[model samples]
Target: MAGSLVKRQGFGTAPVFLTSICTILGAILFLRFGFAVGNLGLWQTFMIILLGHLVTIPTALAVAEIATNQKVQGGGVYFIISRSFGITIGGAIGIGLYLSQAVSTAFYIIAFAESFSPIFNYLLASDFNILVYNYRVISIPATIVLILLAIYKGADLGIKTLYLVAFVLFFSLLFFFLGTTEYAQNMESIPWDAKILNGKSFFYFFAVCFPAFTGMAAGAGLSGDLKNPSKSIPRGTIWATIAGMIIYMVTALKLAISAPPGDLAADQFIMQDIALWGPAIPIGLAAASLSSAIGSILVAPRTLQAIGADKILPNSFVNDWVSQVRLKSNEPVNASIITSVITLIFVIIGDIDIVAQIITMFFMVTYGAICSISFLEHFTADPAYRPIFRSKWYVSLVGALACIFLMFQISVFYSIMALIIMAIIYQTTSYYKEDKEGLANIFQGVIFQLSRRLKVFLQKADPDSKEDHWRPSVVCISSNTFERFSAFNMLRWISHKYGFGNYIHLIEGYLSRETYKEAKECVNRMVKLSDSTKSRVYMDTIVSPSITSAIAQVIQLPGVSGKDNNMIMFEFSKKKPEGLENIVDNFKLVKSTDFDICVLGSSEKNFGFKQNIDIWITSKDYENASLMILMGFIILGHPEWKNARIRLMVLSPEKELEKQRNKIRELIRTGRLPISLNNVELNEHKDNIEAKSIINEKSKDADLVIIGVRTEAIKHDSIGIFNGYEGVGDVLFVNTNKEKEIK
Candidate 1:
């Protein structure tokens, strides 16, 4: 399933331990630790060690937890991340990780060449005329040899080389600890205290030294070759990390006392000076650097090969070529060529400090991602995510946060650049990737848990409480969904920001094998329609035998936003009112639930440029007046109605027109409605003129007209009360069960 799709060598845990220790003790330990000690002093150096391990140890534990939970495959950490986080995010980080590993190989090779500096200087003094330009002469050649070895002999040769180097690494440390120098013997007169140097700040030193502790993951690179990865990975990585930390603390103490700050700061080979045998220091440095290089070389290609096999790259041919392996050994020859090309370019640059900074940033991102995954797994409480080795959620959170904190602390520019690069990779991968699974899939369980808790909490809260601001929790049911979009558009606007809406399409049949399939298909179509409009409305299909039953079921259903649905809407076409009679028949059945009702009469013009809305209110419409005004304001919140204006038309007797106008002015001013006073007109109403005729004459040009409906009129006239608004673009007849205070 991972890394060129081939069988592995099935090596055991020893290789994991040896590979990691060799890397943990590599060039940084011998070359940079003394520099860190002399510059930051003993106490601060120890603090750096602790801080660095704060990131590594938790990450190591997270790695252990994740490794035990899944069947680990060839790409090592990449395999684990992709499987857990899904392909898009995994591919993004995998690319960054692959580059870090490849560049890391070059980093080790350059350090290996640095070990030959004394020999090169002697040759120059003896006039032997060896080619030299800093360490490039050695590094360039060494890079070529390492690449060739990796390409031809593969991981087998690399693993065997690790054992040999690990042995040499032990003696070198032993000799360094055994040796003592004149600088050390004279240090008894001086007080042991932490000193701050004038140049190269503490965090700078910390950043340089931080990469030393990151070697715990080196063993994980050999995941494809391991005999039993589940058993080996956690033990090897955790033990190696613990051992590395202890050794680093001891070495810092030794370096602090053995040499004066001046010698330790000036001399790159301060450890050699403190060693009993000076040559052993360089030999160990060479062994450690070479072993680290071999480890990186072994892993980098497999990650790239796995990425290719997963089809993360854009080109098909390139994917096929890079993913292909040698038939017998399962060696990723083509992927190694790509990795070698990257390594050679960086090696030719030949600056270890610059390369170290780049590696640090990428590795920081990788560690942070791993810790985030572990924390999320614990939070989601997924039954499938039960790992044999479990890490505390808080520990993983700390690790993730520390990685981010240290990244910016080290270099803010690099941290931002690293994040931007990863984002670009994620976007690119998402474009080419066919799978819909992404962050949503990763967070599905967390969202489920949150939603469940919220629904329960909202249910328990006092629904009768009047302290909360009034917002519609609306649900609309329609069999004429495809025939008219006015109701759906209204629902969308209601839920845009301040409210919630659910649109249910009525599938007129009992729930059964055939009806269920039809309902599913109808729901899918509604989903597509919802997406096309970028609506926030939740949609579904109700497979019930009658419109009344569907209405009953929908009213009983909980709101999508966790609050109880407070409003129900019915829609019918003005030209083809096929469901009007059924809706009129069920008005009382719905009215029994104390839900405010809206009957939308859709027009041929479909809300006519959607610019002007008129609200009609009489003296008897105290409850409906506030509801209509609120609905108008809420509809205006949507971008589609952003340019629309609301006109509140209050009708009264000729003498009471001024009184009604004063009340509306108070209402608008008190409630903070956007309706201008000029837009709030009080029209004189004669008792002889029909209300519908006056409405048709006044609001004929309006895009939408909202008027209040009394329960007595609805019960007396049934569907006839809704028939007189033929002149307006579209009409909304609203009724409320309770008073809605604007404030």
Candidate 2:
């Protein structure tokens, strides 16, 4: 709910098309085109225009297709990305897109001020510094006026203004074409060589030209306002892209052929001199700049509003303030205010060249991500990803690669900076995105395909030949985990990372619909526990009159094909639980199914924070020794217990204590455990001392204690030996056989 909103539709295809066209035909076309043409010559300038569109068309197609497939709303590009990739990634890119749009608004307004500087010169007749300084003075007021216009009038007025700007832009283009034709007829020779002038590479010109085509997202950012976004987005976006490409190619051809390269390269404002009417150039520049600024101010606030509503931003006060909408127009009033402040700062302090390059990098990454989403959706073939507008997966893949390639070509340092910034945002927002239900995105489909392939590969492999690759596959029985949480936590810690656990809860009633319903509810609770503990647990429930029979049946079944359950575990209380005798009788039944046994005895106090582990060693029961030490390592591997220290303790006669210590040290060294000889302790006492008493005395301070269970102990009461040591801490009584070896 925090990351989503409902939007009202108002725009149609004409407004969307005009908005996209006006944004692409920005002030840069008038101010920066001559620079690009002069540096790269005629054919290469044309290539830059064509290549920019080539990289952008796929992103436009991806946006249109994805917009049609979903119920699109105010977030625009961010909404599509989040819905496709989930909240974490969506939040990251949304912030970046929002900042880019805000900065673009200032960039355009500053460009507008610069275009009118010649008029200021005509009036003031002052030095260049005074005129240039006055540009900032003009830009601050211009930014404020646009922000107020956007907040009060909303996108409707923005679209209407774009309509007027589109007319002016086309009229100016007509005069430019007419004037260039006359100049071409008079000129005897044209410079056609694609040579770089003033030590500029093709990439430098490409960077300046790239922003010309990046405005395709303007229509996409207004997705929430479209009357029929599903139909209008594809039609409007494609037609606008085609129109911009044609205009760019035509303008590049005319600029290269009509003027001398030396003259074109000398003047950045050559458009004004070359136009049929000189004033029309500055007028067109002003119109284009204002229209693009208005477009950005209209769309950027909505993106901010979307992210704020979804609670992705860190500050709650800021989120609540920015997400507020005006009841009259449903305009992002507060978001627009925040965006205006950021734009004003950029206008005051930001350098146009540096800001332009940074803006290009941000947009390149955004476009790449869009194409990547489209490619993944097609490749994974998720049933929910059906779209009205479809394109080939390879096409989307190529588009994504091209966007990334061009980003580095433009500036590797800026590209890396943009990527690092997005990554940090992703990490921060992912920490706060708590709604798991909202995580249904394309990654789920990708993971599903990967898991399916892995299952196939595992099924075909030889089970016996891969014994060395085996890890623990455990089946644990617990009626109510809350009542025995320590036992459950112990099982989770032991099976963390390298093993899988199947937790079964058996209902003590006749097999009826009511009992089955109750069992299912219990299973859900167990699943929640598994998620909270960050453990790999598959929960199952069964309604049976005989608890022991239910457990035995579950143990006999394999969790995955070709991987049988190798260990069965139960919780031990000092006072025997109900069906204790049946459980004891089923131990042999479990062993017949090739499973070892484990029982946990929990202390009354919660487990300590001290990371100390004690294991009691007697004779060389290598199987049990390996299993116990492995469990110790697993416990220490957890982030909370990373500092845990393990010790192998043995009780022996005084004369043989040294021999026992050497033997245990040799075992640990050969076993390659993360323990050392200093950790192996031998306790020598008189013949009157019992092994259990020795353990109780020595391991009282340890957080966890592990002791191997003999066959005789299993045959009698398994919980009796550990009764005196329950107060020490959590304890695991491990029994192992030669049937299965854990890797």
Candidate 3:
């Protein structure tokens, strides 16, 4: 359910709307103010921009084509690249894409801050610095705090917040265009001068417009998660593109026509001057800028994840829970926070001008690689892809060419800086690739091959193990405290991480208020434990007698289920062995070797508050295979003590045995527990050996030794569990995976 909920969340209409509007406003305004010495008027704007749009259109088309095949993953461009080429290529693209987005967020934040100062400085007493403007949008501390909260809380909450903010920005942009156009008495003429096209001015104009159009594919990536991706994505992309184009066209026209040439060329973000129309106009643009920045933050991380999955980059960078961390109801909260924090870095930057330079660098360079990939889709007979929405080869060719040409238009120095960073990243990534390949090859050939020659390598965690049919019977013991919290933590300590071992929890019986209070504390302590455990079970306390009486009574009463073969574990904190003697005495006569009891250490609530768990479990042998049983408990402590280990062992009668140990080694790979395993299987069956002799030989220096006991059927026998556990000796005998007797 958590998984399903995590998949559906996407950037809602508000983000899309604002992003589109911002696109229109930003494109138009920037194009007009950039004042590329292009003598071209309105009509020539089309041809100059046509080449730029060519560079951008392929990005969207390729994104859509890739999205169609692998839409649900939401890995974005990285996903497309990884699936077609390979994970190594994907990972590289992923890191590059994500870092690009991170850089892009910072750029937008600076842009938002820069756009606001001229309007704010005029009206407020606060003297905003124009010299070092972009970096100081909101206080950096405030922004960082916001970021931490978003991530600490997770993705669902963060995305919703961003979507709402973006919505407000959409209206702001709409109002900026509507507000400005409402007043302009004369429309600027469409000039068709060939002079503007001849020089570097056209290229520079294309360069400036490049970064503005990159965010539209963000919405298209949602196709996989959408209700109907094939239909919805195509429609959304087309609409979003058209929407972005309109905003760009209108804003540019307004800026060029209305502003005196001197004022138009005064600043890059001259769109902010629309406040001259009315006070409210400034508010809209400010809101729009904020939204644009947020929209970018929301879309970028998934791109990295998708790419990471394909192996083009380091898979380690991919976050498993990102798309799934539902915020309030369920939103992409993790991505939002990460994006926002990065955005804030740029926002508070002092130099507003650097904002444009960084933004230019992100789009110009990243897009070049993307366009190159797109070019491959057309030029080469690569079977890797088939376009869902094929642009004519000429269109694809022009887009790729245009993207390449725009790269040159950007300042050579900055372009060099971007390329150098990319090259270093590429080299570092290539080395890592070689190392990973080496490891894979070693594992495939050398390690296993050499293991046969090394005695030490052949030695298993357990030297002597019985034929494990893997039918280790499961016994689930639960009490009122079992699922309450305390036993939960204890179970966690008992279970191994990455999912290993068989486990059982003593669900103590029910009690009156006073005992309930005591039991809850015990349960809380158990739940708070940091030990590695796989599964936790609850025994019905009220089904029979209370926990204290049930331990005594269950032994005397006929056994119901798994009382014969499996050992039962009981946890209590009596310092002296006297209080537990009665518990042991009751079961002593049931064939002494039939079962065993274990006493656990008492838990201390030192700080009153601890990591997610409330219990602490310590086995004499911290490394135990029995820890695998604590899976549920281990998961319980996942909020904290995520890597808590469960050292465990299962003592058998025989001292030496061998069986399927390889499967056991691979069981707990999720990064929690490192298993330490050992086994002692007695050669002779109990009938042939003296009970004393068996006990001495089986548990010479064992931390815990559990055995099975005979069971009887009683009226309350339906409720089966680890009976006579509370008063056992140092060794603990637990039940099997089943509720049957170990006998």
Best by lDDT: 1
lDDT of 2 by residue, 1-743 (tens): 67235456478888768777888988779888888888778888888987898778898899888887888877888999888877778888899999999999998898888788678767667554344446877788888788778878888778878888888888888877777545577866656674445647888889877898988888777876777777887888888898999999888777877776776777777877777887888888888888788888888999999999889898899889999887656788899889989998899884767877888888988999999999889867888888988977887898999998999989999999999988898888878876543346566777777777777777677755746655667888776566778667766765677676777777777888889788778878889988987876677877767766787678876664336688888776544445345556776777776677777766665568748989877754445777787777777766667888998877667887778777766666676545787888878866788677788788888888888876667687653544667447767778886533433
Q: TM-scores of the models, in the given order?
A: 0.92, 0.72, 0.48
lDDT of 1 by residue, 159-267 (tens): 8888889889899999999999776787764335645467468798888889888788888877877889988999998989999999999888888888877677788
Range of the 10 consecutive residues with the lowest summed lDDT in candidate 3: 613-622
- Model 1 poorest ten-residue lDDT run: 188-197
Model 3 error, position 203 (Å): 3.9
Q: Which candidate is the best by TM-score?
A: 1
Q: How would you encode candidate 3's per-residue C-alpha lDDT over 1-743 as one tens digit per residue? A: 44553446444444343444354344324323335423444455565555556666666665555455444456555555555444554455456667766666555555555455555566454464434333363535435654564455433444455566556555655555655433245544533342333334555666565566766655543333445554455455656666666656665565555554444454544455553445434455445445454445545655643443334443454445344444343335555555665666555554545546655665655555555555555554334345566555565556667665666566767667766776777676776665344224323443444434453443433534643422221222344344234333443333323222123234344456766666556555544442323333322222334344554444343222222223344443323333334344444342233433332322233112322221111111123234323332434344344543333332223322122233334444442333344321213333466443544454444323333322332123322223332232233333223222111
Better of 1 and 3 by lDDT: 1
Model 1 scores a TM of: 0.92
For all candidates, what are the clash counts? 0, 3, 125
lDDT ranking from best to worst? 1, 2, 3
For each candidate in turn, give its C-alpha RMSD to the true structure in angstroms: 3.1, 6.8, 21.6
What does the lDDT read for residue 477 in candidate 2?
79
Off by over 4 Å in 3: 1-7, 10-48, 123-142, 145-202, 220-225, 228-231, 267-277, 306-349, 352-359, 378-387, 434-743
Off by over 4 Å in 1: 1-7, 120-133, 179-193, 260-262, 423-432, 436-440
